[model samples]
Target: MSEAESELVQSITTPLRLEYQYTAGVASTRFLRGMADGKILGQRCPQCEKVYVPPRGSCARCGVATDLEVQVPGTGTITTFCVVRIPSDSLDIDPPFVAAHILLDGADIPFFALIQECHFDEVRMGMRVEAVWVDAEDLGPTFESIRYFRPIDEPDAPFESYKEHL
Candidate 1:
């Protein structure tokens, strides 16, 4: 077919919609339950004695199933972050927010949390922050149970102290 003829042909179009049901595994269930209860949970690596937030289920490093549950505190240090200047309506939260990895207290590994209630420019690495939980009505067994993290009154962690975590 000539290029003009091919271009004149109507393009085949079909609307596609896909839905999925995600079943949280044992480790995730336990962690999400903790979030529902307004608590942060971590799994300890039996082999390495390292605590991982959200319960690694198995130690990624030592290749052993995690041992016990450790209660992580809401307050954490911002290990790293990215400031999104672009705006998108599909985002759960508004744009101009910082998406950060937080090193929660008592947990060796960090977890992702949105930084709200503060200016994007004010967010910094090693900044101390705390979780802001959703209301009781919206509470559930998911990360959404906690709204986001906000800056706390504590001083930023020293580079020397959190360098290893980075």
Candidate 2:
């Protein structure tokens, strides 16, 4: 390397940090408020009639505004999932837990959530589950209001019921 380049490579390094805040828009505000009330709110697409949990304010498929509110049950089916065995500083969960894509009943798009109260090996596609929310006193306008999903006594959903979504 050139003498100038060699000297530059030996320069001391310093740490850089950035902090920021995020503002939730109208649609997301509504969804978060619903969570605070112990409700799962979704929006239905006027054109396609598909529902979305934690509404995006618009339908991705039809590219139309989704303003009609729909309240879906806490029950859903596990569309896909993974068994996490790696640890990370950001997550409080221990390893060997299941993380799954859950398609809430009445919603077209699936959302990510933690699976608990069952063995990781037993989690599978189409398994019926239900959200377990924090107590009313602990409820807040955050996704954390629903601690995690757990297996319910309902039968597994048929592949045909959610194949189109996949």
Candidate 3:
């Protein structure tokens, strides 16, 4: 290296640190408030007639502005899932759990959440599941208000029901 470049590289000794704070926008704020009240809110696209859980302010498909909010049932059908067998301290779940894509009743886009309250091997592509909320006392305006999804006491949804989601 050139002498000037070598000296400049050696002179760098401090590390950089910065703090970041985020403010949830209008659509997200409404969704979070609904979560705090044990509700799943979705926004309908007037043009496409599709509903989105955790709604964005605009439609991803038609690019139309989303303004109509709707409540969706917490129960949903599992579209697809993966069995997590690796041990990881960073994750809140134990090994051998499932991470699944679920389509809530009345919502079009599938939502991603954990599948618990049953053996990991029991999770099927079209299994019906329902949200398991944290106790009302511990609820907050955050996604953590919903702990996970558990298998409902119903038969698995027919393949055609969730085929489009997959």
TM-score of each: 0.86, 0.90, 0.87
Residue 166 of model 1 has an lDDT of 78
- For residues 8-91, write the lDDT of model 1, one tens digit per residue: 656778989899998888898999988888888899998888898888599999999996888978998999999987888788
- Candidates sorted by lDDT, descending order? 2, 3, 1
What are the lDDT scores of the predictions, listed in order?
0.88, 0.95, 0.91
Runs in model 3 with CA error above 4 Å? 1-19
User: Which residue pairs does candidate 2 place in steric collision?
Assistant: none
What is the per-residue lDDT of model 3 for residues 61-156, given as tens digits with 9 covering 90 to 100? 899988999999999999999998998978977798899999998888898899998998889988999999999998889988999999999989
Whose TM-score is higher: candidate 1's or candidate 2's? 2
CA deviation > 4 Å runs, candidate 1? 1-18
